[model samples]
Target: MGRFIALMILVIPAVIAGYGIKLMRDTIFTLLNTPYPNLSVQFIAGFILFLAGLGFIGGFIFHRDKKNGKIAPRFKRRK
Candidate 1:
Protein backbone atom coordinates (compact mmCIF):
# COMPACT_ATOMS: atom_id res chain seq x y z
CA MET A 1 0.00 0.00 0.00
CA GLY A 2 2.85 2.36 0.81
CA ARG A 3 4.57 1.58 -2.46
CA PHE A 4 1.37 2.21 -4.37
CA ILE A 5 0.95 5.57 -2.72
CA ALA A 6 4.51 6.52 -3.58
CA LEU A 7 3.98 5.45 -7.17
CA MET A 8 0.82 7.50 -7.39
CA ILE A 9 2.64 10.58 -6.14
CA LEU A 10 5.35 10.14 -8.74
CA VAL A 11 2.93 9.45 -11.57
CA ILE A 12 0.90 12.61 -11.07
CA PRO A 13 3.96 14.85 -11.40
CA ALA A 14 5.17 12.92 -14.42
CA VAL A 15 1.86 13.46 -16.17
CA ILE A 16 2.05 17.16 -15.40
CA ALA A 17 5.54 17.31 -16.83
CA GLY A 18 4.41 15.50 -19.96
CA TYR A 19 1.53 17.92 -20.44
CA GLY A 20 3.97 20.81 -19.98
CA ILE A 21 6.15 19.43 -22.76
CA LYS A 22 3.14 19.04 -25.00
CA LEU A 23 2.09 22.62 -24.35
CA MET A 24 5.53 23.93 -25.24
CA ARG A 25 5.69 21.84 -28.37
CA ASP A 26 2.27 23.00 -29.53
CA THR A 27 3.21 26.62 -28.92
CA ILE A 28 6.38 26.25 -30.95
CA PHE A 29 4.48 24.79 -33.88
CA THR A 30 2.01 27.71 -33.82
CA LEU A 31 -0.78 25.48 -32.52
CA LEU A 32 -2.01 27.66 -29.72
CA ASN A 33 -4.09 26.10 -26.97
CA THR A 34 -7.39 27.98 -26.51
CA PRO A 35 -6.89 28.41 -22.75
CA TYR A 36 -3.80 30.45 -23.41
CA PRO A 37 -4.18 33.75 -25.27
CA ASN A 38 -0.83 33.64 -27.08
CA LEU A 39 2.23 31.56 -27.82
CA SER A 40 4.31 33.40 -25.24
CA VAL A 41 1.79 32.80 -22.48
CA GLN A 42 1.46 29.16 -23.38
CA PHE A 43 5.20 28.68 -23.48
CA ILE A 44 5.71 30.46 -20.19
CA ALA A 45 2.98 28.45 -18.48
CA GLY A 46 4.48 25.27 -19.84
CA PHE A 47 7.91 26.23 -18.60
CA ILE A 48 6.53 26.88 -15.11
CA LEU A 49 4.60 23.64 -15.04
CA PHE A 50 7.57 21.65 -16.26
CA LEU A 51 9.88 23.12 -13.64
CA ALA A 52 7.32 22.71 -10.85
CA GLY A 53 6.65 19.06 -11.60
CA LEU A 54 10.29 18.27 -12.10
CA GLY A 55 11.22 20.06 -8.93
CA PHE A 56 8.65 18.18 -6.87
CA ILE A 57 9.85 14.83 -8.18
CA GLY A 58 13.45 15.77 -7.63
CA GLY A 59 12.77 16.91 -4.11
CA PHE A 60 10.95 13.70 -3.29
CA ILE A 61 13.83 11.59 -4.49
CA PHE A 62 16.35 13.76 -2.73
CA HIS A 63 14.46 13.49 0.53
CA ARG A 64 14.25 9.73 0.23
CA ASP A 65 17.93 9.49 -0.51
CA LYS A 66 18.77 11.66 2.42
CA LYS A 67 16.61 9.57 4.69
CA ASN A 68 18.37 6.43 3.44
CA GLY A 69 21.78 7.95 4.01
CA LYS A 70 22.53 7.72 0.29
CA ILE A 71 23.16 11.41 -0.12
CA ALA A 72 26.66 12.81 -0.39
CA PRO A 73 28.39 14.17 2.74
CA ARG A 74 28.06 17.72 1.50
CA PHE A 75 24.30 17.36 1.14
CA LYS A 76 23.59 15.51 4.33
CA ARG A 77 21.76 17.40 7.05
CA ARG A 78 23.94 18.87 9.74
CA LYS A 79 23.65 16.97 13.02
Candidate 2:
Protein backbone atom coordinates (compact mmCIF):
# COMPACT_ATOMS: atom_id res chain seq x y z
CA MET A 1 0.00 0.00 0.00
CA GLY A 2 1.07 3.57 -0.53
CA ARG A 3 0.69 4.34 3.15
CA PHE A 4 3.09 1.55 4.13
CA ILE A 5 5.66 2.67 1.60
CA ALA A 6 5.34 6.24 2.76
CA LEU A 7 5.70 5.20 6.39
CA MET A 8 8.83 3.23 5.62
CA ILE A 9 10.37 6.08 3.66
CA LEU A 10 9.75 8.55 6.45
CA VAL A 11 10.82 6.19 9.25
CA ILE A 12 14.08 4.99 7.72
CA PRO A 13 15.72 8.41 7.82
CA ALA A 14 14.66 9.11 11.39
CA VAL A 15 15.99 5.73 12.48
CA ILE A 16 19.28 6.35 10.74
CA ALA A 17 19.53 9.76 12.31
CA GLY A 18 18.84 8.32 15.75
CA TYR A 19 21.52 5.68 15.32
CA GLY A 20 24.04 8.21 14.01
CA ILE A 21 23.41 10.52 16.94
CA LYS A 22 23.86 7.68 19.41
CA LEU A 23 27.15 6.67 17.80
CA MET A 24 28.38 10.25 17.90
CA ARG A 25 27.39 10.61 21.53
CA ASP A 26 29.17 7.43 22.48
CA THR A 27 32.30 8.47 20.61
CA ILE A 28 32.34 11.88 22.27
CA PHE A 29 31.74 10.44 25.72
CA THR A 30 34.52 7.93 25.26
CA LEU A 31 36.99 10.47 23.91
CA LEU A 32 36.18 13.01 26.61
CA ASN A 33 36.22 10.38 29.38
CA THR A 34 32.84 11.53 30.61
CA PRO A 35 30.87 9.09 32.72
CA TYR A 36 27.59 10.75 31.78
CA PRO A 37 26.40 12.98 28.99
CA ASN A 38 25.95 16.69 29.58
CA LEU A 39 22.42 17.89 30.12
CA SER A 40 22.69 20.29 27.24
CA VAL A 41 23.87 17.53 24.95
CA GLN A 42 20.98 15.35 26.05
CA PHE A 43 18.51 18.14 25.46
CA ILE A 44 19.92 18.90 22.02
CA ALA A 45 19.85 15.28 20.98
CA GLY A 46 16.26 14.90 22.16
CA PHE A 47 15.33 18.07 20.32
CA ILE A 48 16.86 16.75 17.11
CA LEU A 49 14.91 13.51 17.44
CA PHE A 50 11.75 15.42 18.17
CA LEU A 51 12.23 17.56 15.09
CA ALA A 52 12.99 14.58 12.88
CA GLY A 53 9.87 12.76 14.03
CA LEU A 54 7.72 15.83 13.71
CA GLY A 55 8.94 16.71 10.25
CA PHE A 56 8.98 13.29 8.63
CA ILE A 57 5.96 11.68 10.28
CA GLY A 58 3.88 14.78 10.12
CA GLY A 59 4.88 15.46 6.52
CA PHE A 60 4.16 11.97 5.24
CA ILE A 61 0.84 11.67 7.05
CA PHE A 62 -0.26 15.05 5.82
CA HIS A 63 0.92 14.26 2.31
CA ARG A 64 -0.94 10.96 2.19
CA ASP A 65 -4.15 12.50 3.41
CA LYS A 66 -3.87 15.43 1.07
CA LYS A 67 -3.16 13.12 -1.83
CA ASN A 68 -6.40 11.32 -1.13
CA GLY A 69 -8.29 14.61 -0.80
CA LYS A 70 -9.19 13.87 2.80
CA ILE A 71 -8.10 17.27 3.96
CA ALA A 72 -10.65 19.99 3.33
CA PRO A 73 -9.84 23.58 2.48
CA ARG A 74 -10.49 26.07 5.22
CA PHE A 75 -12.08 29.54 5.32
CA LYS A 76 -14.32 29.10 2.29
CA ARG A 77 -16.77 31.91 1.78
CA ARG A 78 -20.50 31.10 1.70
CA LYS A 79 -22.10 31.38 -1.74
Candidate 3:
Protein backbone atom coordinates (compact mmCIF):
# COMPACT_ATOMS: atom_id res chain seq x y z
CA MET A 1 0.00 0.00 0.00
CA GLY A 2 2.78 2.44 0.79
CA ARG A 3 4.44 1.61 -2.47
CA PHE A 4 1.21 2.16 -4.33
CA ILE A 5 0.76 5.54 -2.71
CA ALA A 6 4.25 6.50 -3.61
CA LEU A 7 3.84 5.43 -7.19
CA MET A 8 0.67 7.43 -7.49
CA ILE A 9 2.25 10.55 -6.04
CA LEU A 10 5.11 10.25 -8.49
CA VAL A 11 2.89 9.54 -11.48
CA ILE A 12 0.56 12.49 -10.95
CA PRO A 13 3.35 15.04 -10.91
CA ALA A 14 5.12 13.26 -13.72
CA VAL A 15 2.07 13.86 -15.87
CA ILE A 16 1.93 17.48 -14.77
CA ALA A 17 5.62 17.92 -15.46
CA GLY A 18 5.15 16.53 -18.95
CA TYR A 19 2.41 19.05 -19.56
CA GLY A 20 4.51 21.91 -18.19
CA ILE A 21 7.35 21.02 -20.53
CA LYS A 22 5.06 20.97 -23.52
CA LEU A 23 3.43 24.24 -22.55
CA MET A 24 6.78 25.93 -22.06
CA ARG A 25 8.03 24.65 -25.40
CA ASP A 26 5.04 26.05 -27.21
CA THR A 27 5.17 29.38 -25.37
CA ILE A 28 8.84 29.84 -26.03
CA PHE A 29 8.31 29.19 -29.69
CA THR A 30 5.53 31.71 -29.79
CA LEU A 31 7.51 34.32 -27.92
CA LEU A 32 10.41 33.92 -30.29
CA ASN A 33 8.16 34.72 -33.21
CA THR A 34 6.86 37.90 -31.67
CA PRO A 35 8.48 41.32 -32.07
CA TYR A 36 11.42 42.33 -29.95
CA PRO A 37 11.17 43.86 -26.47
CA ASN A 38 8.57 41.57 -25.08
CA LEU A 39 7.64 43.11 -21.77
CA SER A 40 10.25 42.56 -19.07
CA VAL A 41 7.39 41.33 -16.98
CA GLN A 42 6.53 38.80 -19.62
CA PHE A 43 10.05 37.53 -19.78
CA ILE A 44 10.21 37.27 -16.02
CA ALA A 45 6.99 35.31 -15.93
CA GLY A 46 8.12 32.90 -18.61
CA PHE A 47 11.47 32.41 -16.94
CA ILE A 48 9.86 31.62 -13.63
CA LEU A 49 7.59 29.03 -15.19
CA PHE A 50 10.43 27.49 -17.17
CA LEU A 51 12.62 27.24 -14.09
CA ALA A 52 9.88 25.84 -11.88
CA GLY A 53 8.96 23.20 -14.44
CA LEU A 54 12.53 22.06 -14.81
CA GLY A 55 13.02 21.94 -11.06
CA PHE A 56 9.98 19.77 -10.47
CA ILE A 57 10.79 17.36 -13.27
CA GLY A 58 14.44 17.20 -12.42
CA GLY A 59 13.79 16.73 -8.73
CA PHE A 60 11.20 14.08 -9.49
CA ILE A 61 13.66 12.00 -11.50
CA PHE A 62 16.46 12.47 -9.04
CA HIS A 63 14.39 11.65 -6.00
CA ARG A 64 12.62 8.62 -7.39
CA ASP A 65 13.47 5.28 -5.79
CA LYS A 66 13.26 2.57 -8.38
CA LYS A 67 12.40 0.03 -5.71
CA ASN A 68 9.62 1.85 -3.89
CA GLY A 69 9.02 4.49 -6.59
CA LYS A 70 8.27 7.68 -4.65
CA ILE A 71 8.97 11.27 -5.64
CA ALA A 72 9.98 13.40 -2.70
CA PRO A 73 10.12 17.18 -2.91
CA ARG A 74 12.88 19.06 -1.21
CA PHE A 75 12.09 20.46 2.18
CA LYS A 76 11.68 24.19 2.56
CA ARG A 77 12.54 26.21 5.64
CA ARG A 78 10.07 28.96 6.35
CA LYS A 79 11.31 31.92 8.29
Candidate 4:
Protein backbone atom coordinates (compact mmCIF):
# COMPACT_ATOMS: atom_id res chain seq x y z
CA MET A 1 0.00 0.00 0.00
CA GLY A 2 1.41 3.37 -0.98
CA ARG A 3 -0.10 5.16 1.99
CA PHE A 4 1.17 2.60 4.44
CA ILE A 5 4.66 2.71 3.01
CA ALA A 6 4.74 6.49 3.11
CA LEU A 7 3.51 6.54 6.69
CA MET A 8 6.13 4.02 7.70
CA ILE A 9 8.87 5.94 5.93
CA LEU A 10 7.93 9.14 7.74
CA VAL A 11 7.52 7.61 11.19
CA ILE A 12 10.55 5.32 11.18
CA PRO A 13 13.02 8.21 10.85
CA ALA A 14 11.35 10.14 13.65
CA VAL A 15 11.50 7.14 15.96
CA ILE A 16 15.13 6.54 15.18
CA ALA A 17 16.02 10.20 15.59
CA GLY A 18 14.31 10.42 18.97
CA TYR A 19 16.12 7.38 20.29
CA GLY A 20 19.42 8.49 18.83
CA ILE A 21 19.16 11.87 20.50
CA LYS A 22 18.47 10.30 23.84
CA LEU A 23 21.48 8.07 23.51
CA MET A 24 23.68 11.00 22.51
CA ARG A 25 22.52 13.14 25.42
CA ASP A 26 23.24 10.45 27.94
CA THR A 27 26.62 9.62 26.51
CA ILE A 28 27.72 13.24 26.29
CA PHE A 29 26.65 14.26 29.79
CA THR A 30 27.70 11.11 31.58
CA LEU A 31 31.33 12.17 31.23
CA LEU A 32 33.12 13.96 34.10
CA ASN A 33 34.86 16.90 32.38
CA THR A 34 32.30 18.91 30.48
CA PRO A 35 30.90 22.42 30.41
CA TYR A 36 27.31 21.26 30.45
CA PRO A 37 26.47 19.94 33.91
CA ASN A 38 22.99 18.60 33.27
CA LEU A 39 21.57 17.50 29.94
CA SER A 40 18.90 20.19 29.66
CA VAL A 41 20.65 21.88 26.76
CA GLN A 42 21.30 18.65 24.97
CA PHE A 43 17.78 17.46 25.58
CA ILE A 44 16.27 20.66 24.27
CA ALA A 45 18.53 20.69 21.25
CA GLY A 46 17.55 17.13 20.50
CA PHE A 47 13.91 17.93 21.01
CA ILE A 48 14.02 20.80 18.55
CA LEU A 49 15.96 18.82 15.98
CA PHE A 50 13.57 15.90 16.33
CA LEU A 51 10.57 18.18 15.89
CA ALA A 52 12.13 19.72 12.80
CA GLY A 53 12.68 16.29 11.33
CA LEU A 54 9.07 15.40 12.07
CA GLY A 55 7.81 18.56 10.40
CA PHE A 56 9.85 17.82 7.27
CA ILE A 57 8.63 14.23 7.12
CA GLY A 58 5.03 15.18 7.91
CA GLY A 59 4.82 17.85 5.18
CA PHE A 60 4.21 15.14 2.63
CA ILE A 61 2.61 12.27 4.56
CA PHE A 62 0.06 14.30 6.50
CA HIS A 63 -2.84 15.73 4.57
CA ARG A 64 -4.15 19.28 4.78
CA ASP A 65 -7.53 20.59 3.64
CA LYS A 66 -6.53 21.95 0.25
CA LYS A 67 -8.84 23.59 -2.22
CA ASN A 68 -7.32 24.44 -5.58
CA GLY A 69 -4.02 26.21 -4.69
CA LYS A 70 -3.47 27.46 -1.15
CA ILE A 71 -0.56 27.77 1.22
CA ALA A 72 -0.33 27.60 4.96
CA PRO A 73 0.37 30.91 6.67
CA ARG A 74 3.65 31.45 8.44
CA PHE A 75 3.55 31.84 12.20
CA LYS A 76 5.26 35.22 12.11
CA ARG A 77 5.93 37.66 9.28
CA ARG A 78 9.57 38.14 8.39
CA LYS A 79 10.94 41.62 8.93
Q: For residues 4-70, write the lDDT of model 1, one tens digit per residue.
A: 9999999999899989999999988999988999999999999999998999999999999988899
Clashes of 3: 0
Stretches of candidate 4 off by over 4 Å are: 28-70, 73-79
Model 3, span 1-79: residue lDDT tens: 9989868866776665565455556566665324324544445555565566667766766655533545344433246
Candidate 4 per-residue lDDT, tens place, 1-79, comes to 9989878877887886776476456757763225445566556556676777777666654343233235455532358
Which numbered prediction scores highest in TM-score against the true structure? 1
Error of 1 at 42 (Å): 0.2
Q: Which is better, 2 or 3, measured by TM-score? A: 2
Task: Say what the RMSD of model 3 is.
Answer: 7.9
Instruction: TM-score each candidate.
Output: 0.96, 0.51, 0.40, 0.40
Please report the candidate that would top lDDT against the real structure: 1
Look at candidate 1 and give me any clashing residue pairs. Answer: none
* Model 1 lowest lDDT segment of ten: 70-79
State the lDDT of candidate 2 residue by residue for 45-74, as single tens digits. Answer: 655765676677777777778777777676
lDDT scores in order: 0.93, 0.64, 0.57, 0.61
